[model samples]
Target: MATQPLIRSDHLFDTVELSKWELEQIMERAAFWEKNWRPGQAPFAGRFAANLFFEPSTRTRFSFEIAEKKLGLHVLNVNMEESSTTKGESLCDTVKTLSALGVEVVTVRHREPEAIQELLTEDTGCKIINAGAGKMAHPTQALLDLYTMKKHFGSLSGLKVAMIGDIKHSRVVRSNCWALGKFGVQVIFSGPESMRDHELEKIASYLPFEEAIREADVVMMLRVQLERHHEQLFVSAGEYFKNYGLSIERFQTMKPDAIIMHPGPVNRNVEISDELVEHPRSKIFAQKTNGVFIRMAVLERALGGVQR
Candidate 1:
């Protein structure tokens, strides 16, 4: 939490690498850009960037694309299915080819947990950003989550964050826990016992759904990643809604000041009630809006070669 060291990270692969100072710096930049960055302002106008999402995405992909355009960077979105990678061209080779062909930055989301890390070792001249990785990291998402929280509450410290649902397959969970670890925030996980993992047991405690909801300052529901679950932990949507999901009855019991959040693709009536998605206290939509500003800061840092 002291002053950030006089250095910069070109690749945003993990939030654990960021200091509280650095986290605040990015949030500050995001807030400034949201209010002040006007039309026709292009800082990287002539430079080129690419979003190579090997995994499917809607929010993170579009958010980064919008941010790149706002920064004046010419953008290319690689269609993974048609890309030569399907013909055995390696991810690194494709990245190297993009760099050689004039891409200044490559934001990637691969199913491989180490795809971005492997690219870092390859020494491509272009900057790399992690959009999301399989069950691992989604740094920008975490930042925007914090940004949204701070926007509503004015601070991150001492906030009790109950991260509910899909912890086992969530890339967002690690980043949020690691980033919040730098602050005084108390983070806990609540979901089916099958959805809990042992890796973060030291950092966050697991609570029953009811206890987590009652004590939290922020209830962050995650999408139930059905696509990623290999094991048969079959609970019907109605079953999930009744127990683990945030039912309307449960919502009434939360602290009056507590807010609701979901990293999105929200399974309405499953992970959360339909009525609460747009509720006065729900920050779900705000998280999406703040995503643009957060990615603006991240793209700037990646292309700027440092945080200013």
Candidate 2:
């Protein structure tokens, strides 16, 4: 397959604008790139990118580093706490300095979803990719998850996916809904009433815990964020787990071919029981592995125009 032009999602109405065929092409390219990867191809050999992460991440951050190095881009990983932002330098100022340094893209993970939009509208010359921003979006995570699903199921068209837990606070949920909905997958939201988002009314069906699990082809669990938890969200973790958590019995309720997925670091015995997470049907590890390949595709597509 010939390499196509890098198309930024910001120009479109939503990331879902990419057709299913186009998405398949990207994933196929990603698989080929991962299998026959060369170290010094230097797709971004002369370019630079900034990894500005306000929130701590292990999988997403390292995956971006791996992707950048694979494409031979010089990566400047900015530590938010150690930077002048802590000293009252605004995000715009930090972005300006980085842009002036000739960075081609700024991949950021912040607590506010509007941060990425603000950077784009502020006239910073750099292209913006939202690694994760607030509970609004985690495009990369959704992409990786879709890549994994495609690799495993071969197609997404008729798959029944039940996204369980913390829908309101999970950027993963928002992104997955958009991506999966684009592929015509039936996304079912299963969580406490407080975590349910009415906005998802357009794309997903809200289902109760046990009913959603029954006959599901994929059960994607979102982390119950302790840090984001408040007294109003739930009475306690125990109550949350009892209502929405995937227990061993619940695992049996799914179709025999159904798989379980979690964007880790998983809260074992909370959002998902340890027994269910380590079961044969679990795709959690595969999801993590797919992150590298998917990010490789994203980086290459985002900055592959530069010659070595």
lDDT of 1 by residue, 1-308 (tens): 22222235488888998889788878877887798789998877788999999888899999999999988889999999999999999899999899999998999998887778899888787889999988899999999999999999988889999999889899899999999888889999989888888787778999988999999999999889998988767559998888788888999999999999999888899999999999999999999999999888888777663333
**What value does the lDDT take at residue 38 in candidate 1?**
94
The C-alpha RMSD of each candidate to the native structure, in angstroms, is: 2.6, 2.5
> What's each prediction's clash count?
0, 0
lDDT tens string, model 2, 31-103?
A: 8777777766766677788899998899899988888788777999998989999999888889889989888
Instruction: Report the C-alpha displacement of residue 142, candidate 2, in angstroms.
Output: 0.6
Weakest ten-residue segment in model 2 by summed lDDT:
5-14
TM-score of candidate 2 on Cα atoms, chains taken together: 0.90
TM-score of each: 0.95, 0.90
> Could you give me the TM-score of model 1 versus the true structure?
0.95
